[model samples]
Target: MDATAPPPLPTRGPAGSPRGGQDDAAQLQLLSVLHYVMAGFTALFSLFPVIYLVLGIAVLSGAMPVDSSTASSPGEVQLMGWVFTGLGTVFFLAMLATAGLVGYAGRCLAREQRHTLCMVAAGVCCMFMPLGTILGVFTLVTLTRTSVRQRFAHGAALPPSTH
Candidate 1:
């Protein structure tokens, strides 16, 4: 090959080959799976606060017994109930929204479209900790790579093979 010739384009290899576009596709696949798992957890966990609020309201309304010493005045109890209800609703809604955004980003990443939007969504996921942190870091690293960016920008002529 001529010294000045550019490197040959990489071919899709057998599963687990360490090639440029293949690596980017694998990373995108991983990100999609992570986002899906996170979305399920977010939807499931969001219900917990709602359940707690309902139980608390029942206790405050005298449908459930409370320790006499720990009980507050009826007015105070009502106020606390209202506050918890509002906060729990906000938290539940926020979690659902985050889940939706992450899921959408995953779809975009898989299709190799809206690259910048996917990066921003991944950055937001980083704030969530644990799984989100892992996914976000991997996403940022993979998507920022020149080869990956080019793949996303120009669109892949063929979908990466799973096997």
Candidate 2:
């Protein structure tokens, strides 16, 4: 209790014990691997937006023509179709890019790098996708913290290395 003594550092686990001194590293590694696998699945499913866009364009452009009885002249129909097709293509590419970026961010996390910037970028790209933005935002939030960042990078909850 000497006044000159520096304050004790906070303990992270059981009383008078350091963290990750046992099986924690292995558990963290497994979780990291699982997170990456889930991210891969997310990336694959995100492609649906792109597929929808292509199908929409095809239908609109008369490439996959609708019932003949419902349309007037093909020329007017074709012009209208092009507009919808173009819009669909734009949205499709946007969604695809979002998914790809998020997938890449997940890979970065699994590799144990500082993924905050990448996650933020992925989240930004996913703003247009319905659930994508929400998931990306969650990932970004979790990855931005100091402890979480360290845990991800090293597959353990140890303090960051000074070297």
Candidate 3:
């Protein structure tokens, strides 16, 4: 119990060492890992649309027949195939692109760079439901913090602390 007990250190502690950023560092590391995992899941789900693509190809190739009861002519069947193909391709490609962005954002976070990219990725991730929403919300919250923003600005990895 001494008045000279060093005044409890500044809120930011030191110049190069973030003394107060330990929590932010840990949270960023965890979020980055989660982003990578989410990216993988998104990429995996993107393949589901390939089923539609394959079915479309089959219809277009004449391997699949159209029901006379449903379609008036062969032309209608071909058009249907095109619709499926186009929609499937669009969804698949879009999801894959999103997955890539999420993964890249995660890398940026880990490296403490590209704060804008990370924020953008988080917002995009929010479009997804449930899990993605959770991750996105958490990421958005973490990135909005003052200390975290400063860390991102520094663009330097926090040194591992030895207790």
Candidate 4:
């Protein structure tokens, strides 16, 4: 061994390669996946209100019975049914729209495009709590990195392989 020779460069791990670019890319990818999963859940839960509206209608129509002791008059039952239906429709549409936006943001994040839009979506995700909070924070942190910003600027679909 030559003492005067420069020390060998550190070997990069599979994920830590790409001049430290892969780490950010991987984090973004994970965040994107989380957004997608959250979107699916949002969409699924949005249907619950619709189902409630349907059941309400059925009860009002007498197809499903209500106990006589607790039952309101037909007019009152009809009004309640309408209210549920209206509220359910509004909630369903709103949640579906939210899910669509999040899903679109996830796709853009995975492609390393639309940085500002992804950041906005992530911020919105932060409002949802629990899973969204985790995903949103991670997304914000990863997307704010200098390297990640450069990757977006370069419009690269994926990080270059170090091999």
Q: lDDT scores for all predictions?
A: 0.78, 0.56, 0.90, 0.82
- Tens-digit lDDT track for model 4 on 74-135? 66767776777777778889889989989999988888999999999898888888888888
How high is each candidate's TM-score?
Answer: 0.73, 0.51, 0.85, 0.74
lDDT: which is higher, 2 or 4? 4
For candidate 4, the per-residue lDDT at 135 reads 82
Q: Please give, for residues 1-163, the per-residue lDDT of candidate 2 as tens digits.
A: 8999999998566421345423334433443454455456555655665665666678665578666677777766676667666666776566566556555655555455655655665456456455555555556555565555555565543456576
RMSD to the true structure for each prediction, in A, is 6.4, 7.9, 4.9, 5.4
Scored by lDDT, the top model is: 3
Cα error, candidate 2, residue 89 (Å): 1.8
- Report the C-alpha lDDT of model 1 over 23-121, residue by residue, as the tens digit: 778778778778788778777877877976786677667776656666567676666667777777788888888888888888788788888888988
Cα displacement (angstroms), candidate 4, residue 31, comes to 1.5
Backbone clash pairs for candidate 3 read none
Candidate 2 versus the native: TM-score? Answer: 0.51
Off by over 4 Å in 1: 1-18, 59-62, 65-73, 157-163
Q: What would the per-residue lDDT of candidate 3 be over residues 131-151, giving only the tens digit for each residue?
A: 999999999999998888888
Residue-pair clashes, model 4: 0
